[model samples]
Target: MVNNILPFDDSDLTKMITRQINRSWNFSSKVEDKLSTELKDLIRQMLEPDANKRPTITKVLRHPWLRDTSGVTGISLTAKTSNVVGKKK
Candidate 1:
């Protein structure tokens, strides 16, 4: 999404990949200035390099920034059920 606004230079791809490998990504200042705090927090949580520390899909659905408070739960039980069914051996 940030790429839509401030495009990344092809020359920066190597540096970006290196940073990702090192788990030291730096978001563009323009993104920080333009996006909301909640959105930024969510993005950060989603980008966590440690799989154990990263938010689960269900947890992400419950995030304040993404949750729908109008009597509608963001997570669907059917999706959960499907996942369980698919995992059955």
Candidate 2:
């Protein structure tokens, strides 16, 4: 998503697979300026080489980036059971 393309090319599938297995694959340098630091950090955490060191779903949800919902607006459906059931429409 960051690069708007796959990190590895289809023509080099074998080499790409080898790099993935070796945990040597990474986003291109070009993406550094294109993505935010927080986003890059989150991506790095998600792609941690060690599974045990990766952030849990809960942790990810609570990350500063996700927690800061300022400027974002959306409808709250918790109290709109009738609307969800098509009763209000």
Candidate 3:
């Protein structure tokens, strides 16, 4: 949908990827002592826009926040169901 809405091609995609990676890194850096090497690299892969180079959904599932499922009842059931369904596929 964003691709359709924006007049972006491969080069623009790369710039957006770079900007997102930098933004994430900056935010993480402010809150933590340092990013683990693995997370830094994974974030790089996550921001990759190339159809082949981006991380898979399952790879993203391994993120630390997703490992915990208890005590987070703030989200709606519909959102939860969509999250579950997205992981299943």
TM-score of each: 0.55, 0.59, 0.37
Q: Please give the CA lDDT of all the candidate structures.
A: 0.66, 0.68, 0.52
Instruction: Give the Cα-based TM-score of candidate 3 against the true structure.
Output: 0.37
Q: Tell me the lDDT of candidate 3.
A: 0.52
lDDT of 2 by residue, 25-63 (tens): 666777778776787788778767578988976577656
Query: What is candidate 1's lDDT per residue for 1-89, written digit by digit as tens?
Result: 85244223447898766665566755677566777677778877887767899998767767877653456667665566557555746
| Candidate 1 segments exceeding 4 Å error | 2-18, 68-89
Give the higher-lDDT candidate: 2 or 3: 2
* lDDT tens per residue, model 3, 1-89: 21123222346777766665454233233433555555545655666657586866665666554544568767544455557757743
Q: Which order, best to worst by TM-score?
A: 2, 1, 3
- Top candidate when judged by TM-score against the true structure: 2
Residue 3 error, candidate 1, Å: 5.6
Report the poorest 10 consecutive residues by lDDT, candidate 2: 75-84
